[model samples]
Target: MGLLDNLKARLAPAKGKVSHLAHEHGHKVTHGLDRAAKAVDEKTKGKYSDRIHTGTDKAKGAVDRLAHKDEPPAGGGDTFTPPRTPPPAS
Candidate 1:
């Protein structure tokens, strides 16, 4: 009945459709991310390996969540998993 509710109702279907599309195209998204990371790493000659890898992993995990959101995720959705942080240097 309210403006926000009405807008949400109208866009709900669109949201689901987009999620489905993302799920279907997950592989391509993944490949693109990898390629970009490799290129960046090569340009930087492995100087940023740890940071780049962490970022790439987080990005891939986000894609996985978006793609598998409609159905039960391998670990289920909205589980609030923590991001991977680097270990403290000895």
Candidate 2:
């Protein structure tokens, strides 16, 4: 293997262990993200409320993606969650 591949090989086991830990404690990690965002928002007096919400959403999505990586896109075993469309106007 090339130097890069050899390095990756050596790191694979550690990576796997870290991944497992993250999966097990994913909710706690998400909570910490929420707390940090709240702290920033309070420190700035809600000046960045919009951006904070956006960032929080993106972060939550990422956490969800990783937490569900082993399951098919849909845990229901459908392999996907169809994008929902808005209801037609009355």
Per-residue CA lDDT of candidate 2, range 23-80, in tens? Answer: 8888898899899999999999999999998999888777766666556555567656
Task: Show model 1 residue runs off by greater than 4 Å.
Answer: 1-13, 69-90
TM-score of each candidate?
Answer: 0.61, 0.62
User: How far in Å is the alpha carbon of 2 misplaced in model 1?
Assistant: 9.6
lDDT of model 1 at position 85: 97
The clash count for each model shown is 0, 0
Position 34, candidate 1: lDDT: 92
Q: What does candidate 1 score on TM?
A: 0.61
lDDT of 1 by residue, 27-89 (tens): 898899999999999999999988999999998888877777546547666687776997788
Per-candidate local distance difference test = 0.86, 0.82
For this target, which candidate reaches the highest TM-score against the unseen true structure?
2
lDDT of 2 at 76: 65
